[model samples]
Each structure stands twice: as C-alpha cells, then as structure tokens.
Target chain A: MAHITVTVDGTSYKGEVEPRKLLVHWLREDIGRVGTVVGCDTSNCGACTVLLNGRSVKSCSVLAVQADGSEVTTIQGLSDGNEWHPVQTAFKECHGLQCGYCTPGMVMATVDLLSENPTPSEQEIREGLEGNLCRCTGYHNIVKSVSYAADLMSAGPTKGAK
Target chain B: MIPVEFDYVKVTTIDQAIAALKAGGEDSKIISGGQSLVPVLRLRMAEPSVLVDCGAIDEMLGVREDGGSITIGAATTHHAVMSNPLVQKHALLLAQATATVADPAIRHRGTTGGALAHADPAGDVPAAALALDASFTIAGPGGRRTVAAKDFFLDYFTTAVGPDEILVSFSIPKCDWGSHYAKFNRTAQAWAIVGVAAVVNVEGGVIKEARIGLTNMAPTAVRASTVEAALVGASSAADITAAAMHAADGTRATSDLHAKADYREHLARVITARAVRAASGI
Candidate 1:
C-alpha cells in the first residue's frame, strides 16, 4: 500500500491506497464522493471525468497513487453553499439531462471546456465534449447547456441564476 | 474493475526510474500518464508486479529546442504537445495528429511518449512520428541510445524499449513541409479504422519531397515509400490519386470488427490520396 495525500474539491484527504486502486474508485468508495459515478468501467465513457490539477481527465484511467499530491475537483464541489455554479445553473436552465446518470460528468466536462474556450462554436462544443457519453442521447440540450454556460460564465459570476 | 495489487514506485529522475525497473524485474511496467496502462490493468490484460511511475520525472516533462530538432519529453502530455509552439512550428504533423487522439479529457492526461511506447497500431501518434522522422531516446542501465521512428515500433503493443529501459524523450527534426493526418473512424473517440499521415514539400505545384505513414495497416506503423516515391514531381490531384493506389503494396492489414483487411486496404488508398492532396495543397 502507498500513502497518498489528495485534495478533493477543497478538502484534503490522506489515505493508504493499494497501487491498483483507481482514482475513481478511491473517490467514490473511500471518500464518499459518489457524485462522480462510474458508467462504463472502461475508459470509453467519461462518466468519471474530474478536474485533475485544473485539467479534465477520466478518473477511471488514473491510478490513485498517480493522483497523489494533486488537486481533484469533482461534481460535488461545483457549487458554493446554496448557489450553483454557472455550469450547474445552465444545465438546469437548459434541461441538459434526462435520466441524469451522465449529468455530473457532463457538467464537469463543460466547466473544463468553457475554461479553455470561453466562447466555443457549436461544432467546437460538440468536439469538446466528445469524451463524454450520454446513453439517454440527450446531447442536443447538453450542447445547449454548454453554450448557455459559456454565456453565464462570460456574463460574470453574479449573473448565475439561483 | 480493480487491478491486481502491485507495488508502486514513483521516481523523479531517469536514473531512479531505471533502478526501480531493474529491481521490479521483467514483469514490471513503467507508467507515465497511465491513460493506456491503467485501462489495460483494469481489464486485467497486463498484470505487472511493479509499476514504476515516471510521471514525476522532471527530465521527461517538457519540450525543448535541440538544435535543428525539438526534444519532447517522454511524459509531455498530448495536450501540451499539440499546443506547444515549438512542435507546431517544427513538427506540425505531430501536433495535428495529437489533436485527434481520444478526446480533450484523454489528451489532458495522455502523454506522447506513453502513446508511442504503448505502440498501438491503431494509435494516431506513431504514424505521425514516423512521417516526421522522430527518434526516440531511451535510457537503460547501460546508458542511453536513440532509435529511429521507423525501427522503434517492433510489433503490436511492443516497442524497441527494453524492460529495464525507460523512454526518455523524442527528438524530431524540424521541417517546413505541409502536413495532414487523414483519419477514418466510426465514432468520435474510437481508434482509427485507418489513418494516413502525409508530409510533403511542394514547389511550383510540383511535389519535391514527400513522406507517408500508414496507421493500422500492419502490426506497426509503416512508411508508404512506394506512394512517397510515386508522388514526387506530380502536380495534380490525379497524380496523387494514382500514386496512392500503391498504398497497400507492402502493408499487412488485418480483418477486424471495424473493417475487413480489404476494406482497410481500400481506405489506405483513398485516405492516402486525400492526405497527400491536402498536404501538397493540390
């Protein structure tokens, strides 16, 4: 077992993890960050996507030990108190999800995407979220949510809908 | 899908990585970004006894100018490589191909060296590296050695890198040639059904020099020398299309779920023509 210190959302957690432990499993089973769900255990589905050191990555494809000393931001840490993040607000406003199984990953991926490209085109948003998969096939509104989130973010933090 | 338990060793230097690999024995595997390796581990395809994490190795983490060539650290992520100005200016084919790998999230965590060392025939970067004439720098107990891109990929999921050796970086020669990677895939994140990496130097509407690399055409990425030779002095799309007909001359394409060997061969011809036309601006 290897001891690792990782900061999730804003809380730092220290644990002894087996070398084989995936970051997604550690986040869900060990620390109770179940917001990051595992869809396809394989890396194809980005249901376990999270921010690793401010960049998006599939947590299932990263070892817990590899994430040692790194900061991870999951879907659980997106809002501040009662106020939702612009991405979260946009998803709700635009009805980005149906079954909601892929919402967390979709929202987190949008945050990362908008961070890089503040104002992406429709094609760019489609290409940006290619890693994520929604079995419900609700991509039309998801793309709408991303574009709306871009608008919300660009309008300033104060403009987020309650 | 939890992987089998194994010992993990994180190293910050190439020498330390070499020592850890030596201590871990032949079953040990070196992991950088863990994009490919972790997936294999979860699938239980590879059960290494020890995993030497080279992600923190300082020497293997950035792109630098090395005279006429640019040296990209083995651990440099695909995102970094694609956006790197040096790589864009020197080896645009690599940047173009790296941009198409997996997706934004995968690119964030996947490293160029990791993809090259993993040596998946369906991967996009190996063919780009071959087209760019990139050379891999590997470090072992006996010291360091450089292997050309043409000779680096030995077989499917295999490389010239030995068990005790760590792939340090890749040195790619600078070239001011038009390049394009024509990739055909069924889905957004799926592996290339067939990919053609083309780099051509055109002068006065005539091809002066050209290099072509085929992906998923064989057990490893191979150069389309016949097509390359046929494309020289050609001034039109017809010439390029005719030249691309020989793309499957020496390729060992295989039948798979995505495409039959013959279909892949046909793709090789069609995609090679498109890539060459775009690369040469015909």
Candidate 2:
C-alpha cells in the first residue's frame, strides 16, 4: 500500500491506498463522496468526471496514487452552503435532467467546459460535452442548461439562488 | 471492477523509472496518465505484478524544439499536445489528430506516449505520427535509442519499445506542407473505424510530394505508399480521387463489429481522397 495525500473538494485527506485502487472508488467507497456516480465502469461514460488539478478527468481512469499531490473537485463540492453553483442553478432552471442519474457528471462537465470556453456556440457546447451521456431528456435541455449556465456565470457574481 | 492488487512505485526521473522496471522484472508495466492501461486493468486483461507510475517524471513532460524538429515528451497529455503553440505551428497534423482523440476529459488525461506505446491500430495518433515522420526515443538499461515511427509499430497492441524500456519522447520534423486527418467514427468518442492522415506539398497548384498514413488498415498503422506515389504532380480533384483508389492495395484489413474488411477498404479509398483534397487545398 502507498500513502497519499489528496485534497478533495476543499478538505485534505491523507490515507493509505492500494496501488490498484481507482480514484472514483476511493472517493465514493472510502470517503463517502457518492455524488460522483459511476455510470459505465469503462471510460466511455463521463459520469465519473471530476476536476483534477483544475482540469477535467475521469476518476475511474485515474489511479488514486496518481492523484496523491493533486486537488480534485467533484459535484459535491460545487455549492456554497445552501446556495447552489451557477451550473447547478442553471440545470434546475432549465430542467436539464429527467431521471437525473447523469446530472452530477453533466453539471461538473459543464463547469469545466464553461471555464474553458465562456461563450460557446450550440455546436461547441454539444462537442464539449461529448464524453457525457444522458439516456433521458434527449440532451436538448442539457444543451440549453449549459448555454444558460454560461449566461449566469458571465453575468458577474451569481444572484440569489432558488 | 477492481484491478488485481499490485505494487506501485512512483518515479520522478527516467533513470529511476528504468531501475524500477528492471527490478520489477518483465511482468511490470509502466503507467502514464492511465487512460488506456486502467481500463484494461479493470477489465482484467492485463495483470501486471508491478505498476511503475512514470506520470510524475519531470524530465519527460513538455514540448521543446530540437534543431529542425519538435521533441515532445512522452508523458505530455493529448490536451497539451493539441494546444502547444510549437506543436500547432510545426506539426499541425498531430494537433488536428490529437484534438479528435476521445473527448475533452480523456484528452486531458491521456498522454501522447501512452497512446503511441499502447499501439492500438484503431487509434488516431499513430497514423498522424507516421504521416509526420515522427521518431520515438526510448530509454533502457543500455541507454537510449531512436526508432522511426514507420518501424515502431510491429503488431496489434505492440511496438518496438521493449518491456523494460520506457518511451521517453517523440521527435517530429517540422514541415511547411498542408495536412489533414480524416477520421470516420460511429460516435464522437468512439475509436476510428478507418482514418486517413494526409500531408501534401503543393507547388504552383501541382502536387510536389505527399505522404499518407492509414489507420485500422492492418495489424499496425501502415503508409499508403501506392496512393502517395500516384498523387505526385496531380493538379485536380479527379486526380486525387483516382489516386486514392489504390489505398487498400496491400493492406490486411480485418472484419470487425464496426465495419467489414471490404467496407473498411472502401472507406480507405473514399476517406483518403477527401483527406488529400483537403490537405492540398484542391
């Protein structure tokens, strides 16, 4: 076992992890950050997407040891107290999800996408979220949510949350 | 799916990585980015006794200019490769192809050397490396050696890199030619069904020279020498179309769930023509 120090959300967690342990398993099973759900164990689905060192990466594809000195931001850490993040607010306002199984990943991916491209066209938004898959809502509302989220983020500080 | 338990050693230098690999024996595997290796590990396809994590090797991490070529560290992620100004200016084909690899998340974590060393025939980068005439530098206990991209891939999921050697970097020559990578995939994140990488030098509206690489056309990435030969001095769209007919001349394409052998051959012809046309600005 290798000892590692990983800062998740905002808290630093120090522990011993097996070399074979995936970052997603360690986050959910070990630390109870179940907000980052695992859809397809394979890397195809982006349900396990999280920000690693300020860039998005699939947690399932990353070994826990690889993230020893890194900071990871999952969906659980997006909001501040009772106020939701701009992305979470946009998803709720635009009805971006139906079953909501893929919402956490979708919302996290949107945060990363908007960070990279603040103003994306419809085609660019679709292309940016290509890794994420949603079996419900046909992705029309999800794309709308991303566009709305972009508007909310660029409008200075976020307003009162619902 | 949990991978089998294994010992992990993280090394920050190439020499230290080599020592770890040598000590771990032949069953030891190197992990960089872990985009491809982790998936295989979870599937239980590869059960290495030791996983030497070389992702933190500082010396093997960025892009630099070496004389007339750009030497990219093997551990450079695909996102970095696509966005690096040096690579974008010198090896645009590589940037274009790297941009099409999986999605944004995968690109952020997948390394150029990891993809090249993995050597999946359906992968997008190997063909781009071949078209750009990239050379791989590998480091072993006996020191370092460079292998041409053409001779690097030996078979399916195999390369000239020995088990005990670590791929250090790739040197791609700078070219003042038009290039394009035309990939056909069922989905945005899916592997290429049949892809073509074309680099063409047009002089006075006539093709002066051309290099073409085929993906998923054989056990390994192969050059379309016949099509390249046929494209010289071609000045029209019809000329490129006619030349692309020989795309599958000596390829050993296989039938898979994505496409039949014959269909892949047909795609090779059609996509090669499109790639050449776009590359030469015809």
Candidate 3:
C-alpha cells in the first residue's frame, strides 16, 4: 500500500491506497467525494472529470498516488455551499441534463472550458465539451448551459463565497 | 473495472527511474501521465508486477531549444506542447496534431513521451513526429541513445524503448515549412481511423520538399515516400493531387471496423492531397 496526502474540496485527506487504485475510486471510496462518479472507466466518457490543480482531468485515468501532492476539486466542492457554481446554475436554468448521470462531469468540464476561453463560439463550446459524453444526446442543452454559464461567469463573481 | 495490484515506486530523476526499471525488470511499467497505462490496466490488458511512477521526475520535463533543434522532455504534457512558443513557431505540425489528440482533459494529463512510447499508430503525435522527423532520446542503465522517429515505432503498441530504458525526450530539427494535420474520426474523442500529416517546404511558389505521414493506415505510422518523391518541384494543384494519388503505395494497410483497407487507402490519397494542398498554401 502507498500512503497519499491529497486536498479534496479544500480539505486535506491522508490515506493508504493500493498502487493500482484509481483517483476516481480513491475519491469516491476513501475521500468520500462521490460527486465525481465513474461512468466509463475506459476514459471515453469523462464522467469522472475533476479539477486537478485547476486543470480538469479524468480521475479514472489518474492513479491516486500520482495526485498525492495535488489539490483536487470535485463536483461537490464547486460551490461555497450557499450558492451553486455558475455552471451548475446554468445547467439548471438551461435544462442541460436528462437522467443527470453525466451532468457533474459536464458541468465540471464547462467550468474548466470557460475558465480558459471566457467567451467561446458555438463551435468552440461544442468542441470544448467533446471529452464529456451524455448518452441522453442532450448536447444541445448542454451546449446552451455552457453558453449561459459563460455569461454568468463573465458577469462577475458569484453572489456567494469564492 | 479495477486493475491488478502492483508495487509502486516514484522516481524524481532519470537516473532514479532507470534504476527502478532495472530493479523491477520486465515485469515493471513506467507510467508518466497514466492516461494510457491506467486504461489498459483497468481493462486487464496488462498486469505489470510493478509500476514506476515517473510523473515527478524533474529531469524529464519541459520544452527548450538546443541550437536549431527543439528538445521536448518526454514528460512534457500534451497541453504544454500545444502552448509552447517554440513548438508553435518552429514545429507547428506538432501543435496542430496535438490539438486534435483526444480532448481538453486528456491533453492536460497525457505526455508526449507516453504517447510515443505507447506507440499507438492511431495516435496523432506519432505521425506528426514522423513527419517532423523527431528523434527520441532514450536513457537506460547503459546510458543514453537517440533513435530516429522512423525507427522508434516497431509495431502495434510497441517501441524501440527497452524495458530498462526510459524515453527521456524528443529532439526535432526546426523547419519553417507550412504544415497541417488532417484527421478523420467517427466521433469526438475517437482515435483517427485514418489521418495524414503533411509538411511542405515551398520556395518561389514551387514545392521544394514534401513529407507525408500516414496514421492507422498500416501496422505503424508509415511515410508516403512514393507520394513525396512525386511532389518535389511540383507546383500546380493538379500536380499535388496526382502525386497524392500514390500516398498508399508500398503500404501494408489493414481493415478494421472503423474502415476497410480499400477505404483507408482511399482516404490516404484524398486526405494527403487535401493536407498537401493546404500545407503548400495552394
């Protein structure tokens, strides 16, 4: 077993993980961050996407030990508890999900995308979220949510805590 | 899916990594980004007894210029390669191809060396590397050696990198040629069914030299030498199209679910023509 110290959702957690333990599994099982769900462990469906040191990556494709000295932000940690993240609020407002299985990953990917390209064209938004898949084929709404989220974020900081 | 348990070791330097690889022997796997290795492990495709995490190895990272060549650390992430000024200015083909690799998340985690060492023919970087004539620098207990990109990839998912050797970096000669990577994939984040990377060195509105790299059109990334031979000193679009017609000559393309051999061969010619035309600015 390998010992790892990682900060998730602003809280540091220390644990002994097997070498083969994936970051998605470690986050869900050890760190109790179930918000980052593992949909397709093959890295195709980016359902386990999370912020690793402010950059988004599929947790299923990363070993827990690789993230030992890194800071992780999951879906549950996207907001300050009082208000929803801009992407989350946009998803709700734009009806960006159906069945909601891939919503967390979609929202997280949008946050990373908008952070990089504050204002993206329709094609850019679609291309940006290509990694994250929605089986419901609700991409039309998901793209809308990203556009709405870009607007929300560009409007300035959220009403709640940073 | 869960991977088989394995002993893990983290190395901070190339020497330490080589030492671990030597100690672990053939049963060990060196993981840089874990983007490719982890997926295979989860699928039980490979069950290595040990995993040497070289992610923190400071010696094997970054992109820098050495005279007229750009030496990219094997551990440099695809995102870094895409954003590096030297790469964008000197070798834009790499940047163009790297942009088409998977999506944003994978780009942030996947490394250039891992992609080359993994040696997936469908990977965008290998074809780009071949077209750009990049040399892979490998280090082992026996010390360091450089292998040309053309000779680095041996077969499907295999490379010239030995079990005890780590691909340290890739050195590519700088080129001021117009380059483009045209990929045809079924869906977003899908591997290229058939792709072409073209680099054209044009002078006085005439093609002086042409290098074409084919992906997923053979057992390994193969160069369209026949087409290249036909393209030198060619200027007109008709000349390029006629030359690109020979793109699949002397190739051992195979058929898969994504496409048939004939279809891939056809795509080789068509995409090669398109890539050459765009690259030569005609």
Candidate 4:
C-alpha cells in the first residue's frame, strides 16, 4: 500500500492505496461514490469521466496514485448536495439517457464542455462528447441536453456551484 | 483490469530519472504523461518492474527557443504545444497535428515527445515532424547527442534510442514554406487510416520545393520520394496531382482492422492531393 492524498469535489481524503488501484475504482469502490460508474476497464468507454484539476479525463485511465495531490470532481460533486447540477438538470429535462449506464460520465463531460465553451455549435457539442459513448438514446437528445445545459449555466444562477 | 504488481517511483530530475532507469535497467520504463504507456500497461501489453514517472520533472515540461530551432521539452503536453504562441506562429504543423490526436482531454495530458517515443506509426505528430525535418536531442550517461527526425524512427514502434538514453527535447526549425496536414479516418476521433503532411514552397507559379510525408501506409512514417521528385518543377494543378498520385508507389501498407492496404493507398493519394492543394494555397 502507498500513501496518497487526494482532494475530490472539495474535500481532502488521505488513504493507503494499492499501487494498481485505478482512480475510478478508488472513487467507486473505496470511497463508495458509486455515482462515478466504471463501464469498460479499457479506456475506450468513457463511462468513468471526471474533472481532474479542472480538465475532464477518463477516471479509468487515471491511476489513484497518480491522482495524488490533484483535485477531482465527479458526478456526485456537481451539486451542493441539495439540487441537481445545471448539466444534470438539462440531462434529466431533455431525457438525454436511456439505459443510464453512461449518463454520469456524459453529464460530467457536458459540464466540462459547457464551462470551456459557453456557446457551442451542434458539431462542437458532438465532438466534445465524442470521448463519452452512449449506447442508448441515440445521442439526439444528449446533444440537446448539452445545449440546454449551456443555456442554463450561462444564463441562470446555478453557475457558482461548479 | 488491475495491472500486475510493480513498484512505482516518481523521479524529480532528469539525472535522478536516468539514475532510476539505470537502476531498474531492463525492468524499468520512463512514463511521461502516461497517455500511451498507461493504456499499454492496462492492456498488459507491457509490464515493467519500476515506472520512472517523468511527469513531475520540471526541466522536461517547458518549451523555448535557443537560436534557430524552437526547442520543446520532452514532457510538454500536446495542449501546451497547441497553445504555445511560438509553436503556432512557427511550427504550426506541430501545433495543428498535435490538436488532431485523440481528443481535447487526451491532448491535455499527452506529450509530444511521448508520442514520438511511443512511435505509433499511425500517429499524426511523427509524420508531421518528418515532413518538417525536426531533430531530436537525446540525453544519456555518455552526454547529449542530436539525431535527425528521419534517422530517429527506425521501424514500427522502434526508435534509434538506446535503453539508457532519454529523449530530452526536440528542435524544430521554422520553415517559411506553406504546410498542411490532413488525415483520413473513419470517425471523428480515430487513428488515421492514411494521412499526408506536405511542406511546399510555391515560388512564382513554380514548385520550388516540396516535402511529402506519409502516415499509416508503411512500416513507419515515410517521405513520398517519388511524388516529391515528380513535383520539383511542376506548378500546374494537374501536374502536381499526377505527381501526388505516386505518393504510395513502391510501398507496402499493412492492412489491419481499420482498412485494407489498397484503401489506405487510395486514401493516401486523396489526402496527399488535398494536402498539396491546401499547402500551395490553391
């Protein structure tokens, strides 16, 4: 076991992690933050997306030991623990997901995307979410969800929580 | 899948990193950014005893200019390369090609030196570097030595570098010639099945010079010598197109799950023509 200190979503947690513990596994298994799901152990499926020090990365590709001393924000960290994040709200409002297996990662990717590009074209949205794959919902509604999230965050009061 | 048990040590300086690599010797590997090495480790494609993390080395994480060539630290991320004003204004081929790797997230962490060191023939940066005639500065126990880009890549996934040597920086010359990079792939974020990087100097309606580099059509990123030879004095669109068609002649393209060799050869010509036209400003 190796000692590591990671700041996730705002709080600091220190623990002894295995050298092989992936960041996604640490978030979902050890910390019990199941909101960050793991789909494919491989990096292809972006089901374990998270914000690492502000930029979005596949949590599955990030090692927990490598993530030491970094700030990570997952789907569970989006809101103030009371209401849904703007992107999450948009995802729910626009009916973005079907099976919901890839929703958390998609929502996180959307959150990072809208933050970087406040106003994105339809093609930009498509390219932005290319890393996150969704088998269901056909991505038509998911694109709408990202656009709606952009509008809500850019024009509404839920901006400070991100 | 969890990687097999291995001891990980994060080294801070180049000397320390090199020392660690030598300590572990054949059983160790240097990981900078982990964009490529991490995936390989996860797939069990490579397993080493010690991972010398070069990501934290401050000396290997910057971009600067010495005299004529712009020197980039080995650990500088692709995002940094794309955003750097020096690289954008001078080595735009490097910047442009770096942006097309995987996606924005991967770019944020992937390093230019790592990609070339990893030596994936289908990757965009290596071919661009080859077209621009970049030189690599490698550091080892003996001292520092510079290797030209053409001589650096030996084969598919093989470089001229020895085990004890570490690639410290790449020096790219500022070519005033027009350049363009084009990759033909199946999806928005996939490896290039076939691609071309063209650097041309169009002087008074005459093709004064042209350097054409091909990707995914051979064992390594290669120069289209036949096409380049045919293009020296030809300026007309038709002549250039005809010359560009020979980009894949006398070559062997490895057919994989992505596309067939003939299809890659076909796409090579197509992308080469587009690259030539774009670079020619026609």
Candidate 5:
C-alpha cells in the first residue's frame, strides 16, 4: 500500500490505500463523506461527481491515488458550516429532486456550470448538466433549479434561501 | 464495480514513467487521466497488474506554439486544449469537437493523448485530428519517434503505441482552413453513431482544398479522400452535396444496435454535406 495525502472539503487526510481504491470509495469509506453517492460505478452516471481543484469530475472514474495532493470538495462542503449554498437552496426551493439519489452530483455539477458561465440560457444549462443523469423529475425541475440558482448567485453574497 | 487489486506508482518525469513501464513489463498500463482506463478496469475488461500514474509529469503538459505549428503535450487535459488560445486560433476544429466530448467533468479529466491512444472509432477527436493531419510523437526505451495520425490507429481498442511506449504529444501545422464537426448521437452524451469532420480552404469562391474524416464508419478513423478529391475546385453547395455522396465510398462500416451499416452510410453522406457546408462558410 502507498500513502496518499489529500485535502477533502477543507480537511487534510493521510492514509495508506491500495492502488485500486477508487476516489468515490475513498470519499465514502475512508473520509466518511457519504454525501457523494455512487449511482453507477461506470463513468456513465454522475452521482459521484465532485470538485477536484475547483473543477467537476466523476469521482467513481478517479482513483484515490490520482487525487494525491489535490483539493476535493464534495456536496457536503458546498456551504459555510451553517447554511446551504445558493445552488442547494435553489434545488430545495424549486423541487429539483424527487428521490435525491442524483441530487449531490447534480448540485456539484451545477456549481461548476454556473462558475464557468454565470448566466447561461436554458439550453446551455441543459447542455452543461448533460453528464449528470436523473431518473426522477425528468430534468424539467432540475433545469428550473439551475436557473433559480443562477439568479440567486447573481444577487451577490447573500445566504441561500431558507 | 471495484477494480481488481493492482500496484500503482506515480511518476514525475518521462524517463521515470518509461522506467516504470519497463520494470512492470507487459502487465503494467500507463494511467494519465483515468477517464478511459479506469472504466475498463472497473468492468474487468483489462487486468493490468500495475498502473503507472503519469498525471504529475509536468513535461507532458500544456500547448506550445513553434513557428507554424502547435504541439500539444500528451497529458494536456481536454479542458486545457479547449480553452487554449493557440488551439482556438489555429485548430478550431479540435476545440469545437472537444467541446462535444463526454461533458465538462470528463473533459476535466480526459487527455488528448489518452483519447487518441484509446483509438475508439466512435470518439470525435481522432477524426478531427485526422482532418487536421496531426502527428503523434511517442517515446519508448529506444528513444523518441513520430507517427502520422493516419497510421497510429491500428484496430478497435488498439493503437500503434506499444505497451512499453508512451504517446508524448501531438503536433499539427497551422493552416487557414475553416472546419466543422457534425456528430449524430441518440442522446446528448451518447457516442457518435456516425460523425464527420470537415476542413475546407476556399479561395475566390472555389474550393482550394478539402479534407474529410469519418468516424465510427470503419475499423479506424478513415479519410473520405474520394469526397475530398471530388470537392476540389467546386464552389456551389450542390457540388458539395454531390461530392459528399462518396463519404462512405471506401469505408467498411459495421451493423450494430446503435445503427445499421446502410443507415450509417446514409447519415455519413448527410452529415458530411452539412459539415462541408458549414466549413466552407456557405
């Protein structure tokens, strides 16, 4: 086993892990960040998406050793300890999820999309989140949530809606 | 879902990676972005005993412009290539096709070299690279060498890159060609059933030159040289449409659940016409 040091959600972790340990497993098993779910072990489903150095990546497709010395932010770390991030609030208010299985990955992917294109058209939002799939909701409400999140984020540093 | 047990070593230099490959022998597979290899490992399609991680190799990263050509490092992420000014200005086809790859998250992790080395006929980048006449530079124990992109892809899930060799970079000449990529997929993220990459150089209302590359219509990404030959000196959209009918002239397309060979041929012609029209700015 090789030792790897990584900073997840703002906490630095050092552990001896096997080479084959996937990042999604490492996040849930080793670091106790169960918020990042693995809907499909194949890269097709994006339920395990997270931010690696501020860019979204499917954690299920990434090995823990590959993330060595990198900073990873999962759905659990999106907000300051107390309140939900704007994207999170937007999802809740807009009813963006039904089963919530794909929520964490979808929300994280949106954080990436909005940061890249602060004001995207509905088509652009749909295209941006194409990698993340949802069986419930048919993506209509999820698109609305992203639109709402964009508006909330555009309103400046106010805390997300309650 | 979990990959079988394997030994892993992360390397910081080209030589170190080469040495690791040599020591680990044939069972060792090089992992750059892990966007492709990891999935295969998870599915148990490959059982490599060791994985040499080359993600930290700084030498094999970024884009460099030299005189009339740009050399993209093998490890350069798709996101980096998509956003690079040099690629946008000179190789816009690459940038345009890259934007359509997997998605933002996969783009963040997949590398140009990895995609080319994977050599999947359904991938968009290989056809784009072929239309641009890109050259791949490789390094192995015997030293370094270069191979034309046309000769790089040997078969399905195979490449000219030997197990002991690493694809170092890809270089393409600067040209005044306007290009377009036309891809057809059932879903937003599905692989192309049949795709076409077209590059056109027009002067004085006549086609000065044209290069057409067809993807997933053959065992390897093959050039629509017949269509290209028929398009030279042609000006009208009708002329382009006529020439594009030959898009599948020499191809050996297959019949699959996604699309039948005949349907793929029909789509090839239609998409080639569309790509050529957009590329010629007509």
Candidate 6:
C-alpha cells in the first residue's frame, strides 16, 4: 500500500491506497463521492468523468496514484453547494436527463465543455460532448441540455448559480 | 475492473524515467498520459511488472520551432498540438489529425508520442506522421538518435524503440505543402475504420509532388505507391480518383464487425481521393 494525498472537490484528502486502485474506485470507496458512476471499466464509455486540473477525464481509466498531486472535481463538486451548476440547471430545464444514471458525468462533461466554449453552436455542442455517452436519452435531450447550458452561461453568472 | 497490483514509479525527469525503464528492463512499461495503455491494463490484456510513469516529466511537454523544423515534446498532449501555433504553421496535417483523435477528454490527456508508439492501424497519427515525413528522436543510456517515421514503426504495436529507450520527441520539417486528413469513423469517439493523410505540392496547374499515407488498410500505416505513381502527371479529379483506386493494392486488412475487408478497401480508395483533392486542390 502507498499513502498519497489528493485534492478533491477543493478539499485535501490523505489516504492509504493500493497502487492499482483506480481513481473511480478511490472517488466512490475512499472519498464517498458515489455520484460518479463507472459505466464501463474500459474507456469506451465516459460515465466516470471528472475534472482534473480544469479538464475532463474518465476517472476509471486513471489510477489513483496517478492523481497524487492533482486536483479532481467530481460531480459532487460542481455547485457552490447551494444550487446546481449551469450544466445541471440546463439539463433539468431542457429535460436532458431521464433515469439519471449518466447525468452526473454528462453534467460534468458539459460544464467542462461550456466553460471552454461559452457560446457553442449546435454542431459544436455535439462535437464537444462527444466523449460523454448518454444512452438513456438517446443524446437528443443531452445535446439540448448542453445547448441550453451554453446559452445560460453566455448570459453570465446569474443563470447558472440560481 | 481494477488492474493487478504492480509497482508504480512516477518519475519527474526524463533521465529518471529512462533509468526506471532500464532497471525494469523488458518487463517494464513506460506510460505517458495513459489514454491508450490504461484500458489495456484494466482489460488485463497486458501484464507488466512495473509502470514507469512519464507524465510528470515536464521537460517532455511542450512545442517549439527550432531552425526550420517544428519539435514537439513526447509528453505533449494532443490538445497542445491542436492549440499550438508552431505545429499549426509547420505541420497542419498533424494538427488536423490530432483534432480527430478520440474526442475531447482523450485528446486532453493523450500524448503525441504515446499515440505514435501505440501505432494502432486505425489511429490517425501514424498516417499523419507518414504524410509529414516526421522523424522520431529516441533517448536511452546511449544518448539520443533520430529515426525516420517510415522506419520507426516495425510492426503492429511495435516500434524501433527498445524497452530501455524512451521516445523523447518528434521533429517535423517545415514545409509549404498543402495537407489534409480524411477519416471514416463509426461515431464521434470510435476509431477510424479507415483514414487517409495526404500532402501535396502543385506547381503551375500540374502535380509537382504528392505523398499519401493510408490507415486501417494494412498491418502498419503504409504509403500508397501506386496512387503516387499514377497521379504523377494526372491533374484532373477523375484521374486522381482513378489513381486512388489503387490505395489498398499492397496490403492485407483485417475485417471486423464495424467494417468488412472489402468495405474498408473501398473506403481507403474513396477517402484517399477526397484527401488528395482537398490537399492538391484539384
């Protein structure tokens, strides 16, 4: 076992984890951030998405040890704790999610996307969130949510925080 | 599934990383970015005794233009390649193909050297490297040496890089060549069923020079010699398309559920033509 410290959700965490423990397992097991789901242990599915150093990455594919000195933001980290992030708000208003299994990852990936492109075109939205998969909604609603989030984010801080 | 337990050493320097690889020897795996190798490990397709992490080697992470060539560090991410102006100015074919690689997340983490070293037959980088005539700079205890991209790839998932040697960087000569990449993929993030990269130089309405590299049509990324030969004097779209029909002439392709061999061959021909037309501007 190796002892490592990770900064997750803006909080410092110290734990003793095995060398092979994946970041997804660490997120759920050690950190108790169960909102992050691991749809496919392999990378083909993007269900276990998270923001590492301000970029989205499939958490399951990364070993916990690899994130030793990195900052990770899971789905649980999105809001300022009072409300949903812009992506979550847009996802809800646009009816972008159903069953909600892939929502957390979709929301996180969308947050990363919209921050990079505040006013993404419809096609650009689709292309930006291509790494994320939302089978429950057939991606129609998810794309809508991303588009809505882009609009809301373009409107500035008012729409997202509320 | 979780991977088997193994010693993991995240080295912070290129020399340290290379030393770890040397100590671990043949059973060691040098991992950077881990976009491609991680999945393989989770699936248990490969079992290495040690993983020498090269992600922390900051020296291997950036792009710059020196003299007449654009040099990109081995650890530089695909996103960096796409965003860097030096790469855009000198190797636009590389930039465009880098954009088409796996999607945003993978692009954010995947490294240029890792992709080239993986050398998947369906990958876009090898073909792009071939099109640009890039050279790889590898380092080991013996110091540094450069190998032509054509000779760098030995076979499927294999390269001239030995276990002890680290792929330090890649250097691509700057050119005024017109370049383009055309790929046929099943989805937004799926591997290319077939991809083509073309670089052309047209002089006075006739073809002065042309180079074509094909993906998913052979064991390794191979050049379309027949197409190159046939398009030498032909300046018309129809003639180039006819020449591109021979794109898959020299290789054996494996068929899978995504696409059959015959269909892939057809895609190679069609994509090659489109790439040539766009690149050669005819």
- Model 1 chain B poorest 10 in a row by lDDT: B1-10
lDDT (Cα, tens digit) per residue for candidate 5, span B76-168: 999999999999999999988888888889999999878988889999999999999999999999999999988998898788899999998
How should the candidates be ordered by lDDT, best one leading? Answer: 1, 2, 5, 3, 6, 4
Off by over 4 Å in 2: none
Listed for each candidate, the true contacts retained, as a fraction, are 0.98, 0.96, 0.94, 0.44, 0.88, 0.83
Model 2 lDDT, residue B147, Cα: 99
Q: Write the per-residue lDDT of candidate 3 for residues A67-94, one digit (tens) a residue.
A: 9989999999988667788888889888
Query: What lDDT tens digits, residue by residue, belong to model 1 across residues A18-72?
Result: 9899999999999999999999989988999999999999999999989999999
Compared with the true structure, what per-residue lDDT tens digits does model 2 show for residues A1-162?
889999999999998999899999999988999999999999988999999998889899999988998999999999988888999999999999999988988998899999999999999999999999999899999999999999988886655286
Please provide TM-scores, in order, for all candidate models, with all chains considered together: 0.99, 0.99, 0.98, 0.95, 0.99, 0.97
DockQ of candidate 6 relative to the true structure: 0.82
- Candidate numbers sorted by DockQ from highest down: 1, 2, 3, 5, 6, 4
TM-score of chain B of 5: 0.98
lDDT of 4: 0.85
Candidate 6: fraction of native contacts reproduced: 0.83
Q: Is 4 or 6 the stronger prediction by DockQ?
A: 6
What candidate 1 keeps of the native contacts, as a fraction, is 0.98
Residue-level lDDT tens digits of model 2 in B1-282: 899988999999999999999999989999999899999999999999999988888878999999999999999999999999999999999998899999999999999889999999999999999999999999999999999998999999999999999999999999869999999999869999999999999999999999999999999999999999999999999999999999999999999999999999999999999999999999
Candidate 5 is graded, for docking, as high
Residues B189-215, model 1: lDDT tens digits: 999999999999999999998999999
Clashing pairs in 6: none
How well is each residue in B43-126 modelled by candidate 4, as lDDT tens digits?
888888888888878878888977777888989988899889988877888887887888766777779999988888999988
User: Which of 2 and 4 is the better model by TM-score?
Assistant: 2
Candidate 4, superposed: residue stretches over 4 Å from native: A158-162
